[model samples]
Structure formats: structure tokens, C-alpha cells
Target: MQSIAIVLMGIVGMLIGWFVYSKFIANHIFKLDENFETPAHELNDGKDFVPTNKVVLWGHHFTSVAGAAPIVGPAIAVYWGWVPAVLWVVFGTILFAGVHDMGALWASARHKGKSMGALSESVIGKRSRALFMIVVFLVLLMVNAVFGVVIANSFVSQPDAVFPAWTAIAVALIIGQLIKRNFKLIPLCFIGILVLYASVFAGSYIPVALPETLFGLADTANWIIILFIYAAIASLLPVWMLLQPRDFINGMQLLVGLLLLYGAVFFSLPDITAPAFNSQTATETPSIIPLLFVTIACGAVSGFHGIVSSGTSSKQLNKETDARFVGYLGAVGEGSLALITIIAVSGVTLAASPEEWHAVYSHLGAGSVDAFIKGGANLIANGWGLPVEFASTILAVMVVLFAGTTMDSGVRLQRYIIQEWGDIYNLNVLKKGAVATLVAVGSCLLLAFGAGGSSGSGGMIIWPLFGSTNQILASLTLLVISVMLIKLKRPAIYTLVPMVFVLVMAFFAGVIKLKEYWLADNYLLVFLDAVVLIVSVLVMLEAAAVIKRFRRGD
Candidate 1:
């Protein structure tokens, strides 16, 4: 019953959040004008700016931002307890995330669909735009590297997922070709999904596990290299090709998988087994205040969500009113996924006896990525009587598959930022897609080697940085949106308060991380943390300057 209640609560909460956001925040506050022209229509290039179906665009937006964060965050942050994680995922999305996401979409549409980096120049100032661009570029670099690590690790952990995961690319390519050739939508969707599931099932019997080590590198590292090569190629392609279609298919898989878990829980109604709190092991657990805010970013509020909104989704929105659904409701979808994760992990862990529960969570990584795979798999298998090992492979494949989509998006966004930088400095080659892509992929490789090392241990070392930088990025994005709103003489406080709060929390978290890394002599992370903090502080200072001008009636 506990599991069922948790699932029900999350669904009801997200629906309510979706409704309130569309009605009060998006409709009343942003005053969404249905007839307003959008960038997708005005600049329909059929490549990057393809005017897409609202449903397809929502799937893309949701899956792109809906990658590993929501799954990983709650899985790990359950250290503080499932209750707090659940509360934050539910309320945080409603109050802060929905507004923040919609603000990005509305701001971008109103400003000709420029990314947050470009918007900084007009809304804040040119110098800060450069600063903001660097921040976004660095963050995306980490994003790509992290997803590479994630995909590689998924393959290393679950060999049965590999063949099916790779096969899905073919499915995406075929789907893209069909769409380009003007195939019927209904039949195509059915064919695509059918092919996708067939691949997953086939992959189970014909697992393609790589050797444990190759050329003196961990299998995970080797897999990371291969994944990046794919990302580099895929990222350079048109959105409608591999990126959109693959994401759409992955979104469907995710939807069906979650529904299966929900159905299982509703039927079985498992009891809560994990402790409601774990403060007794204070040394092992983190405090829930600033850490919780940083740790559980995507499920609640994330800066990257805004990036996806303003950078990609805004350009593809077919109508002005669609911004409400694309931005706010996409976030609500992410929140619901996070809530489901909390329930699955919490219930599964609680289902175990005390001795077994302790054994499961004994390791550092146990509560995080491992937990999501095992816990989520447990929920699905136990509920449906599926084989646990096979269902686990299915879930692992799902994670790696979405990780690919996100990495592709990250590299593409990085390319855009680099080209814009070239425009600022007048380097023609930089504007060239080939040159910009090389630079983007090259930077990703460097970051990958440093962050993951040969074995990818360094990836874990810098994991927390993702959450802090993510929230800080959200703060910076909100700052610009707030400035834009104030300039138009509308209510800016809707975005301002969350901006300030995120800025403070992320800034504090970064400082603490920097100190810890310095003391541990983890110079790489210490340097990374220093850059994140300095850039964020400068950006926040820029926000201050903008606010000052507004107060002076400028």
C-alpha cells in the first residue's frame, strides 16, 4: 500500500502541478499569446529548426533533460530519507521548476529564440554574455563526458543491454528516413516501437559483452571512447535524423517501463522498508539543506532544463501557446519520474530485512546509479513476475539509451556555443560545422580523460560538481529571464526569488566542495570547482548590476 500510495501521490501531484502551471503561471503570468509567431515557423530550416508536432517536441524536451540526474539524485539522496526526497521532488517542481522552465521558453520565444548564453548579452551585458557562454560550454562538456561514462558503465555492468542498445540506432535511422520520406505517422510509430522492443528481447540472448580490459584500459573507458565517437558523429547530424527520432523512441520506452512499474506497485502495494531517516550514520550521510538542493536538482529545479528549453525546444515549438506544455509540463514529467524512482528504491529497500538492506547499501555507489538499476529492476520484476536479471538488463539498456540522446544534445549545444564565440571574435573557421565539431569533441575527450581517467574513477570524484554547477546555471538563466521580465515592466519576482535562492545554495556548495577537494589534494576537481564558483559569482554580480539599473529606472 505504501508503494501504491507513493505512486498515486506523485501522479496526482504532477497533474496538479501541470494544471496550475498552465493556468496561473504560464497563462496569467507569462500571458501566452496563442497567435504569436514562433521561431520554428519564422525560421523553418528543416534541420535544426524543424517545426515539430507538440507531442514529439514534448518527448524530445522531456527525454533530453530527463536523463540520469533524476534517477541518480533521488537514488543517492535517499541517504537523508525517502520522505525528504519525495517532498522536494513534489513541491520543488511545482513552485520553482515549472516557473523556471516556462520562463526560459517564454523568454527565448520573445527574444527570437536565442540561447541563454546569447540572451545574456542583450539582457545583462556583452562581457557577461561571454562569461555565461563559457559556463554553459564547460557544463555541457562535463555533461557529455558524464553521459559517456554513464553509457559505458551501463554496458560494463549489464552486458545483455549492449546489442539491443546499439541496435536501437538502426531503428532511429529507419524511423528518421521514413519521416523524411513522408510516411504515415501512426503506422510509423507502431513500427518503430515494435522494432525497438524486439531488439531489447533479442539482445538478452545474444549479449555482446566487451573484454574486461583492452589496450591496458578498463572496458568502461574503452566503451566511453566508442560512445563519444558515436556522439561526435551523431551530434553533427540533423536533429530530425538520429537525435529526434531516437529520443522519441527512448521516450516511449521510458513511458511504457514506468507504467509497468506503476501498475505492479498498484497491484501489489508493497510496504515501506527503508528507514524514514538515517541521521544516526552522520559520517556516511549528508545534511539535507544545501546538499539536498544541489543533489536532487533535475527532479526539482535544474539549470540545464532551462538550457534545453531556450536552446532547442523554443526553436522547435510550432506555436506560442505550446511553450507552456513544452517547458513547464516537461519539467513536471521529469519530477514525476524522480518521484517514481524514490518510491521504487524506498519500497524495495524497505522490503528487505534489516540485514539484507544493510548489505545492499553497504558501498558508496550502492545508493546511487547502482540503486536505480537494482531497485528499479526489483520493482518491475517483483510486480510482474518477470525474471529479475532480464528486467534489470532492460532498465540498464534504457538508461544507456537515453544517456546517448543527452550526450548528442550536449555536443550539439556545445557546437552552437563555439560558433557563437567564433562570431564574437571573427574566426570564420569556427563557424564552419566541421571545425566547431572537432573543437567540441576534442574538448570532450580532454575532459573525459581527466574526469574519468583510464578506469573512470575520476568521474565519481567530480559527480557532485554536476549538481552545484547545474543549480548555478539555473540561477544564471533565471537571472537573465528576471531581467527581461523587469525590462518589460512585468512581475519579475516570480523568477527572482528562486534565482537568488539557487545562486546562494549552489555558491555555498561549490565553496565547500572546493575546500574538500583542496584538502584531499584532488587538484583536478579543486581547479574545476574553482572555475565553476568564480564564473558563477561573476555572473551573479552581473545580475546585481542589472538589478541596480532596474531600481534606478533605467
Candidate 2:
């Protein structure tokens, strides 16, 4: 019953956000016009810049931005208590994420589809652009490397998901060709989903696992290398060929998965077993004040959203007016996923009572994606009468697919950033697509293997820094958008308030983590943390200077 109430409240808030608040922002703040020519039309090259339907574009944006962060973040943040996590996700989606994401898409589209880092130059200053790109690259590096580890981890732990996960790619490739040939999307979507689920059913019956070691590397390490190799090829292909269709399919699958999870909550009416505010937190758990904001980043507000909005989604925008649907609603979709995740992890399905709940979540980061999977599977088995094994496979594939899509977009965005640097410095070598992709993929590989050593799990070594760094990027993105709004003479308060709030929280979190890293003698994370903090401060100061000049009409 408590879980049901939470679900109802979250859904209602999101509805109001999408129908009423989003429309208001779209009309007045963004001033979206259907007559405006978007970059997809202006720079239609049949590759990265192809005009796409709002529905398909929304699918891509939602899943790519989602990844496994929302689930993993909320699942872990429950150590602080579900109330704080839920509040941040709901209000943050309405006030912070919706505005920031839509603003980035609009800002980038208005400037011919430049990434936020590149767009910073037009809105702020040249030095801000360089600084923004550095932050952007670091965030991308963290995302690509971390997500590869996440997906590889999933494959190793949930071998049953392997068959359906790879099967999704083949299905997407076929769907992509069909979409390109002018087939009706309605029919293609149905067929693709049917095939995907059929594969899921087959996967449950036949689980696959790699040998203990492949090529003298651990299975997880081999999977990480293989996943990146796949992502590199997928990134270089035409947007219509793999990225768009694959994300669309994954988006639909996630929607179905969410409906099932939410339905189980309502049908079973699970009680909330976790405390509203934890009284027995692990002694090492940091203060929830600043950590909560950064811990549950993607579900609440994330800097990575702006990167995808401006980098990939902006390039595929078919209409300027569609920004509201693709951007705001995408945030809404992810919030809903996060909402259910909180319930799935905290409800009776996970623990019969409060004591059991605390035992399971004895420490920060105790219950992550695995907790969500187990709880969600139990819910499905209880409510829908499905076998837990099959339910587990479905949810596992959901996480893998979402992470896979993010990897695709992350690598491609990294390539775009590298090529932008090439243009800025007059280096023709980096301008080539293949060369840029190598650098993007190569960098992530270096981080993974170089840091993790034999396990290729080095991404996890830097994972703790991701939350604070990602939110800082989000605040910086909001800062860029706020400055743009002010320059246009429109009301900028919407973006400004979120910017100040997120920056302060993320900055504090970074400082806290820096101290912890230093004490632990993790010099690599300490160095990376210092770099992000310094770059963020410099970019903020540069933007402030530009805003001051703009206010003076200089």
C-alpha cells in the first residue's frame, strides 16, 4: 500500500509536469516554433544528421540518457532512505531536469546542433568552450568506461540475459533497414517487440556464459573489450542504421518493463519496509544532504542529459516544437523508472519487515542493480505468476540494453567532441570519423584496463567519483543555458535557480570525496577529482564574466 501510494504520487506529479508545466515552458521560456528550421533539416547528411520522427527521437533520447544510472542510483541511495531520493527525483524532474534538458536541446538546435561544449563558446567565451570540452570529455570518459563495466558485469552475473541482449542488436539492424525503406513504423515496432520478447523467452531456457578466461583474460575483461569493440562499430554507422532503431526498441522494451513493475506494485500492494529516514545508517555513510543530490543524479537531474540533448538528440530533431516532447517527457520517463526502482528496492518484496530491509542495505552502495532485479523479479512472480528466473532475465536485459545504448551514444559523442577539437586546432587527422572513434574507444579502454589491471574493472575504481562529477556537469550545463536565456532577454530564473543549487551541492560532494580519496591513497581519483573541480570553477567564472558584459549591453 505504501508502495502504491508512492507510485500514484510520482505518476501524478509527472503528469502535471508534462501536460501543464512543460507546455508553459515550451511556449514562453523556450518559445518553440514549428516554422524554425532545426539542424536535422539544415544539416541533413543521411548520417548523424537525419530528420527523425518525434516518437523515435524521443525513444533514442530517453534510453540513451537513462542507462542503468537511474536504477543503480536510486537502489543505492535508499541507504539514506527512500523519502529523500523520491523527493529529489520528482521535484528535480519537474523543476531541474525538464528545463535543463529542454533548454540544452533548444539551445543546441538554435545554434545548428553544436554540442554543449561547443555551444558554450557562442553563449559564454572561447576559454569557456575549452574548459567545457574538458569537463565534457571527462564525463564522457567516465560514462563510457563505467557503462562498459556495468554491462560486462551484468552479462557475467546474469548469463541468461546474454542471448536476448545480443538478439536485440540483430533485431535492431533489421528494423533499421526497414525504417530506412519507408516501412510504417507502427508495424515495424510491433514486429520488433514480438521478436525481442520471443528471444527473451528463448534466453530464459538457454543461458550462456563465457569460459573462465578468454585469451588469457578474465571473462568480465573480455566482455568489456568486446562490448567496446561493438560500440565503436555501432557509433560509426549511420544514425538510422543502428543507434536510432536500437534505442527505439530498447525504449519500448523499458516502457513495457516499467509497466510490468508498476503493475506488480499495484497488484500486490506491497508495504514499504524501509524507514522513511534511516536511523541505523552505516557509520561511513556520508551526510545525505550533499551526497543524496549527487548519488541519485540521473533520476533527479544529470549533466549527461545535456550532452545527449545537444549532441545526438539535437542533431535528429525534426521540429523545433518537438523539443518539449522529446526532452521534458524523456526526463519524465526516466523519473518514472527511478520511481519504481525506489519502490522495488524498498517494498515488502525485497524485505518482509524493516529489520530485514536494513540488514540487506547495511551500507551505502549495498543494494544496486542486483537488488532491483531480485526485488522486481519477486514482484513479477507474485503479481503476474511468472517464474522468477524469467522475470529476472527480462529485467537484466533491460539494464544491459539501456547501458548498451548509452555506450553507443557516448562513444559517438566522444568522437564528435574529438572532431570538434580537430576543427578548433586545425588538425585534419582528428577530423576523420574513424580516427576520432579510435581515440574515443581507445581512451575508454585505457581507462578500464590501465586502472583496473587484469580484471578490466578499473572503471569501478573511478565510479565513486562519477556521481559528483556528473552532477557538476549538469550544473555547468544549466549555467550555460541560463546565460543563453539571459542574453536573449527572456526570463532566466528557471535555469538559474537549479544551476546554483546543483553546483553548490555537487561542489561540496566533490570536496568531500576528494578528502576521502586522499585518505584512502587513491591518487588517480584524487587527481581526476581535482581536475574536474578546477575546470568547473574556471568555466563558471568565465560564464559570470560573459553574463556581466551581456547585462551591461556590451
TM, every model: 0.95, 0.99
Q: Which portions of model 1 show Cα errors greater than 4 Å?
A: 213-217, 349-351, 362-365, 450-453, 456-461
lDDT of 2 by residue, 165-251 (tens): 999999999999998899999899989999999999999778889998989899999999999999999999999999999999999
Q: What is the C-alpha RMSD of each candidate to the true structure, in Å?
A: 1.9, 0.8
Question: Quick one: best lDDT, which candidate?
Answer: 2
lDDT score, candidate 1: 0.80
Looking at model 1, report the run of 10 residues with the lowest lDDT sum.
Answer: 278-287
lDDT of 1 by residue, 1-554 (tens): 67677677877888887876557877767888889989888888877787888777887888898888888888877767778788889888887898888889888888788899998998998889888887787678778877888888788777888898888888889888898889876687778888877888888888887788899988888898888788888877888888878888888888887787777787667777766775434464545678888889988999888888888888888888888887888888888788878876777533475455555656334677777777777777778888887777777887777778788888888888888889999999999877888898887777677755677545455665788888999999988988887787888788899888888888888888788788889897898888888888888788788889878988
Deviation in Å, model 1, residue 423 alpha carbon: 1.1
Q: Against the unseen true structure, what C-alpha lDDT does each candidate score?
A: 0.80, 0.93
